[model samples]
Target chain A: MGITRRSFLRRAAVVLAGVAAAGAGWSYLKGLAQSANEAPDQAASLPSAPVQQRTPQPHHWAFVVDTTKCIGCGKCVAACKEENNVPEDPHFNRTWVERYVIDEQGEAYVDSPDAGVHGFESWPVNSKYQNIQVVKSFFVSKLCNQCENPPCVQVCPVGATYKTEDGVILVNRSRCIGCRYCIQACPYGARFLDPNLRVADKCTWCYHRISKGMDPACVEVCPVGARMFGDPADPDSAVAKALRENRISVLKPNLGTRPQVFYIGLDQEVR
Target chain B: MQHLTRPVLLLLTVFLLLGAARWAIPRMFNQISFAIQDRTVPVGTLLGAGGHANVPQDIEAWKARQVQYAGPASCTQCHQESVAQWKVGDHAGVSCETCHGVASDHTANETPLPTETSSALCTLCHSTTLGRPSSFSQVKVHQHAGEATCASCHNPHNPGVQGLPTDLIRPKPSAPLVQHVVVAEANCTMCHGQGRLRPYPQDHAGWQSPGCLLCHETGPTPTLVGASATLGAPFAGLVQAPSVPHVTDGVPSCTRCHDSGAVRPFPQDHIGWSAGVCLLCHQAGPAPAVGGTAVGSPAAGGGGDAPRGVSISTISADGLPPLPHTVVGYTQCQDCHGSDQFRPFPSDHQGWEITECLLCHKSK
Candidate 1:
C-alpha cells in the first residue's frame, strides 16, 4: 500500500508545502516581533526624562511663499543660483518665478523667462495677452515644496533621496543612480537633473544653511520678504506666524503631496 | 533501525533539495524575480554584496559635499570692522558673501575675493522694474545717476549721501540742494564748466543754481520715499532699527525667535533682515507706543516668556526620546557605544548621528 506511486508523490508534496509554510510564517513573526520591540523601547524612554533636561523640540521646518508679497523680483532665483551653483542655463532652475496673466475670458498665460534670473520684465514675445483683455496679472514663484509625502522619495530607485527629520527632502548625490524617475514623479516639476554633477538636483531649502541655524540664501536676499523659512515648532518663527495668520494653500493640492511650502494668496490658475 | 535511518536521510535530502530549488528557480527567472522584488531586479545589485556597504558610505559622501559659502560668521573673524559697519548699514541684511561671491575658498585658501563695484551690481536689486516691490528702494539707473557711479555721491558702506553740503543732509520739503558747492560763484564755469568731468546736463548746460529753481526746483527729484513710513525710524545709531519689545533673555538666538517661523516673527516686509541688526534698532524690553510695530504684545500677555502655544506632544512625534546628553561635539555614536566601549548599544542599535539619535534618545 505504501509503495503506490501517486500516494508517495502526494506525501512528498505535503511535506514540502509544510516546510514552505513554516518558513513564511517564521519570517512574518520575526518582522512583527521587530516592530513590536521598537515601540516599547521608544515609549519607555521618553517620559522618564526630567522636565529641565528636555532637548530642543524636534523641528518641523516649513517654507512660506507670500505671492502677494512676492514682487516677482527674481532676486530669489538669483540668490538661489549663486548659492547652489545651479546651471547658468535658463531652462534649469532650483527656483523660478512664473508670471501668470489671466484674461477677461478666463484664459491664463504663463511664462518664466531665463527662470526669472533677469526678472519678469519681458513678457511672452508673441504676446497672447495683447489680443485678449487681461483681467489680472501676478507672479508665482515655484520651488521644491519638500512634500511630507514626497513622490520623488518614493520613486528613487536607490535610497538616495530621503526626508530629513526636520521635513526637508534631500537627495544624496553619491547614491543617486542618475535615474530621472524622481524628476518625472514630482507633480510640482521641482526636480532637475544636474548637468554638471550628473545627479538629480532640487532645492534643499539650503540644508547647509538651515542646519547651521541660518536662513536659506533665497530668503536671505529677498528684499521684500516674500520667501520665509523656519521651524514651526517655535511659535515665534515667521513660518509659524505666517501659517497661523495667512490663508495658505499648496500647489497641485489635488494630488495631495502635503507640501510644507505654504503659499499665501495663491492664484486659482497656478499649478 | 537501518531501514528507518535510510528513510529519514532520504527525506532530509529531498527537503533540502526542494528548498534550494525554490530559492534559486525564481531568482533565475527575471519576471518571477521582478515580481518577488516588487522592482526591476538588476543583476548587478542582486549579485553584488557591496549594496549594503553603499548606504553609509553614500551618506558620508553626501555629507562631504563642500559647502562653498563660508557664511558671514567666517568673515567676522578677520573683518570685524567691515562686518560691524555693514551690519549697521542699509545693506545689513545682505550677507558679505552675497556681493563678494562665495567666501569658502577665500577663508580656506586666503583666495583674493571678488569685489563688485559696478553700477550693474547695484542695479541688480535696486533698479526700478515692474516686479520689484514698490516698498523697496529702486531707481531708474540712467535717471538716478546720469553717467556718475553710485559710489561718487552715496557711500558704499552706509549708502546715505556723503561728502555733500551739511544742510542737504536734512533737506526741506522745498530746498534746491546743490550736488556740489559752487567753487567760483561769479565764474560758474570754473566748476560747472563744459570741460568738467560731471558737466551740467544737456538741458541745464546754460542755466545756473538760482535759475536752476525754475524747473529743477523740487529738490533733486525726491529720493524714493515710498517706503519711508515703514522703513523704520531715521538712522540715529543702533536704536533706529526696531525695538525687540519683548524680554530677550533665554533666547540664545534672535533668529530663533524672530525668524519667519518663530512665534513672534517679524513682519513680512522685513525679509532678508539679519540678526546682526536686530539689537541695533530694536532695544530690549517693551516697545515704545509710538515707534516700531508692537511685535510681542499678544504673546507678551502670557506672563511666562516661554514661547506660548507650542504643542509639545508633536515636538518629537516618533516617540523616541531625545538623548540625555547633547551630541553637539560628538560626531559618532559608535565612538563611545561600540561593542567594547562604555554603555555599549543594546546589541541592536546601529550607527547613527545626532539627526538619527534624536529619533529615539531624548537629549537635554
Candidate 2:
C-alpha cells in the first residue's frame, strides 16, 4: 500500500515531539539534583550570625564657664600649667588669660602673655602697650575651642585626627606624622605643634578623662567658674542646658568648624 | 526515468528521513528540555508539538537573600589606626553602614573585592548640611581644595592633646631696678603715673609720680629715673634734662624743656613733642646736625654747601640768619664750604671745630 503525503508528515511530527519530551524530562531532573547538592555548601559558607544591635543607653557629658563669675585671676592658668606641663613660651599649650578692655571711647584692647607664676608681674616690661581704660574689662581664658567640625582634622593627611562619637576632636599620637597641617588649617590658631612629640596637637577636650567619666582639668581648675563641659546631645547636660538658656557664640563662625567650645561672652575681637 | 520500484522508493524515503532528523531532532530535544526545566517552550517547538504543553506552570524561582548590615567596629580590626582615631573623634558615633552602604559583601568575600564607595562616602557624614556643627561638610571642606580630610592632623583613635605643657620658663630681667619697678606696680601704673603724665616718667614728678608705662607699656617707654640710670649716663642725663636737644646738643628731658614751646625760644613746631614723641629721642640714633660748623658743615656761596642729601633734616641753628647772611651767601653754608673753613667763619672759638655739636646744642 502507498503512503500519502499527509500520513508521512504526521508520523515525522509525532516522532519529534516524543524525543523533545524525553530530553526535557532528563534536563529538569539533572538541575534539581545539582541544586540539592550545593545547598549545604552555601549554608556552611555563610558568615557567623550578625552581631546583635546594642540598645542605645543614655550617656551624656557637658561643661559650663561663667564669665560673670570670673575675676581675671591666673589661678586657672597656673593649674593648667601644672596639670598639663605647659611650656613656658606663650606660643605653646597652656591657656592664656586675655584682659578684654572696652573703653568709654568704644575702643577694645586685649592684654595677654601676662599670666604666669608671678602673674602680671611676669609680663615683659618691654612688651607692646595694651590699652586698659575701657568701659568694661573682662578676663577671657583662651584655649582650644574643640570645634565639632575641626578644621585641623579636615586638613590632616595621615588620617591621624578624628572626631569622637561624643563630639570631641582627637589625635592618635602613634599615627600622627607631625606635619602641622592642622595648625595652619585651624582658623582659631588653636592647634600647636608639640615640640616634645613632634606632632600637631590641640585640645582633646580631655578624651582620656571623658571616656573614663571625668571633667577636663581646665574646667576643674577654673577658679572664677569661667569654664564648662558637658554632652550637647543630652538636653539635661550642662552644656546643653546653657545653650538653651543663654546666648553662646563659637569662635570663627565663618570658618564653620562648628566648635564644641562655646563662649558666653565672646567679643568680636576674640574670634 | 526507471520503472517504479519499492526498494528504490524505500531508500529515497530513508534518505529524506535522515535529512529531516538532522534539522528537527536537536531542536525538538531543546524544546522538551526547556519545558521540563520550567522554561517557556519556544514558539517553533510549540507549533511543532501541535500546542501540547507549550507553557510551563513551574517557573524556576530566583531567590535573593536578605542583606546584612555591619557596624564600623568590624572595619576597625583591619584598620586599627583609623578606628583608634575615630574612637575619640566627633564622627565616632557614625556607623559603617552609614558610609559603605551594606558591608555584607566586603565581609563575606574571602578575597578583597572592589568597593563601590568613594570620597562621596565621606561626604555623607561630613557634609555641612547633614553633619553636626564643627563637622566638615563636603560643600564647605571642598573649598579647602584637597587639603581638607578627616584624618588631616587628628588621630582617629587619639585626637590631639590640646592645652598641653609648653615647658617654657621666662628669663629673669637683667636689671634689678627693672625687676623692682615691675614688682612695685599692680600693673604698669607704678612706673607710669596715671593719665598722660604716666608716659613721660622723666618729667620730674612724672618719674616720681608715674611713668609712660601706665599705658604705653608695650612699645618703648621714656626711660624712667632708675631705668634711665641703669641704661647709662646718656639716658640718665637726658631723663634729668628738661627736654632732649638736637643731636648737636646733649639729650633733653622729654617733657621738661618741651613745654608748649611758648615758654622756650625754640620753635613750638617740634614734631617730637607730638604723640609718639618717644620715637624721636629713643630712635635708632641721633640725626646729623643741620648747617652747623661740625662734621656736615656747609660753605658760604659754594655750590657744594647745599644741605646734605640725607632724607631726614637735622636740627637747624636756632639764632642763625634765614640764609644769604653777610658771612654766608647761601641759606645752607655746608653746601659749598668744608667743616674746617666754616668753623672759623662762625669765629671758631671754644674749639668749635673740635667740639661735638651734641655737647653744645644739648637742650637746657
Candidate 3:
C-alpha cells in the first residue's frame, strides 16, 4: 500500500492546520496570563502599603510648584544654582520662575530668565493687550513633577530611569544610554539633556540631603516656605493632607501619566 | 504519493506567507518619519525639539527684536535701605533674574519698562514644608490677608537683617527686695514655709519669724539667728555651724567676727561656747548650749567637778561684745597661759577647743 499523492496532501494540510491552531491557542493563553497578572484596574487598587504602613523615613523630597503660589521670588532657583554648582553659561540642574499676567481684555504678558536670585523687578506693569481692565497674574515655578507612573520608565530601554521605593523618580547615570525618551515622555518639561554629561538629567529631589536626614536645598532655604514634600500614601503626611484639604490638580491629566506632584489654588491664567 | 506531496507543500507555503502578512502589515504602515530640510528623520525628534533650537535662524532673529528687559540693580540702587537689610536676609544671595521675568525690557526701553507682579510670583520660590513652620498660607493669602510684599518682611537688596528690627526691646529686671524666684519650688518653700511663716517654738524666733516680719518685712535674713532661721535651721544651737555650709563658712556674726584682720579667738576671749566643738564630744545628744550664760557651767553639785576659779565671760544678748583678752585677737589663748591655766578654766572641756597658740604664732 503505497501512499497516494492526495493522501500525502491531506496529511500535510492537517499538520499545517494543527500548527496554526496551536500558535493561536498559545497567543490567547499568553494574553490571558498578562491580563490576569496586571489588570489596570487592579494595579490602581494595589495597596500602597509601603507608604502607609512603614515608619516614615525622613526624606529631603521636593514639590512641583503649582505656578499659583510662586511669587516669582526665584529664591529656589538661586539656591539650586549655588548649592548644585550649576554651570554659569548654560544652567544645569536648576529651575527658574516664570511670570504670566493676563488682562481683563485678554492681553497676555509673559516674562522669564535663566536665573532669578537678585529678585524679579519688572512686575506691577501693564499687559501688552489693549483695554485690559483686570489683570490675572501668576508665577509658575518650573521643576520636575516626579511621576509615579512615569512614561520615562517605560521608554528607557536600559532601565536607567527608575522609581525609588519612596516614590522619587531618579536616573542611574551610569546605566543611561543617553536616549532622551524620559525627557520627552515627561509632561511638565522637567527633564533635560545635560550638556556636560551628554545624558538626560533633572532634579534629584536632593537625594544627598534626604539620605542624611536633612531637607532638600530648595525646601531648606525657601524664604516663604512654598515647596512641600512627603509620602502621598500616608494620610497624615503634609503632602497628602494638603491634597485632601485643598482643591488640587496635576498637569496634563489626559496623558495618563500618574504624576505624584500636585498643585493647589491654580489659576486659569497659568499654563 | 509524489503528486500529493507537491500540492501539499505549495499549500503549506501559502498559508505561512498569509500568517506572516497578518502580523507584519499594521506595524509597517504605522511607522512614521519626518522631513527635515528635505531630509527624513524620526517624527519623535521633529515634535520634541524645543523652538529655541528648532526654528529657522531668521525667525530667531526676528524674535530677539521683541525681547523685554529690566536690570535688578536699578531697583537695588533706589531701595538701598531695603538692600542693606536684605544683605543680611536669608534670600540675600538670590539674583534679580530669579523672581522678575527678565531684563530685556529695561535694555530695550529708554525709560524703565513697566513690570507686572503678583503673590503668585512669590510662590514660585517659596512653598510649604512637612516639618517646621508647617502650614504656610498660599501666596494669595500672604499678599491679601497679611498685607505683605516680598520686600515687606524680606529685603531683596541686601538679603541680610531680613525683616527683623536692628534695635530689639530688652526686658527689665525686677527690684532687689522683690526677689524674682525662677524655680519657685527650689527657692521659696524650701526656706520659708507656706505663707512665709516660721515653723514653731518662740526660742527660735528670727527675722523670718511670723512675729518679726510683722514689723521688719522687707529684707533677707540679716542677723545670724535670722539668717539661720530663713535657711531653716532646727534651733539656735545649730546656727553656729553654717546652715548652707557649702555656700559659706560657719561664722554667723557678720560684724563681730569679720572686722578687718582680727583673728577669731577660742576658749579665752571666745565669749560663746562653739556648737561645732560641742558636737565632737556629745555626738548623739540633744543640741548643746550656745552663746548663753548657762553654758560651760558644771552640772549641779559635784557630779562633774568644776575647775577652780574659772570665770568665763559669756556672749552678750543685746548685741554687746564679750570682755577682750589681754593678748588681743589671738586665735589660741592657752599657749601663753599653761595647761595649769587651762585646768583653772574648766574641766570636762573636751580637747576639741584650740589650745596651742605658739603652733600658729611662729611667723608672728
DockQ of each: 0.07, 0.02, 0.05
* lDDT string, candidate 1, B52-112, tens digits: 4444434333333445555566777788778777777787766676567666667766779
Better of 2 and 3 by DockQ: 3
lDDT of 1 by residue, A1-271 (tens): 3455555667768987787667656654664586566556434322221211112567788899998877665778887888788888877899999878777889888877788787654435324455767677777888999998999998777666888777888886645556688999999999987756657899988875665566787887675678898877778788899999989899888888999899999889889
Per-residue lDDT over A19-64 for candidate 2, one digit per residue giving the tens place of the 0 to 100 score? 7777766655765686677556545543343443322554444445
Ranking by DockQ: 1, 3, 2
Best by TM-score: 1
Candidate 2, residue B190: the lDDT equals 37
Name the candidate that leads on lDDT: 1
Give the lDDT of residue A207 in candidate 1.
74
Better of 1 and 2 by lDDT: 1
Candidates in descending lDDT order: 1, 2, 3
Q: How far in Å is the alpha carbon of A218 misplaced in model 1?
A: 2.3
Model 3 chain B weakest lDDT span, ten residues long: B31-40
Q: Which regions of candidate 1 deviate over 4 angstroms?
A: A1-57, A71-75, A101-108, A120-138, B1-59, B160-364
Off-target runs (Cα >4 Å) in candidate 3 are: A1-68, A90-94, A115-118, A122-134, A233-237, B1-364
lDDT of 3 by residue, A1-271 (tens): 4677667767777987787667656654664575466555433432221211235464324353444444555667766665454555434545666666666677766666554553454333322323445356666666677776788877876565666656666765434546678878777777776655545677666554343333455654555545666655667666767777778877677777766667776656555
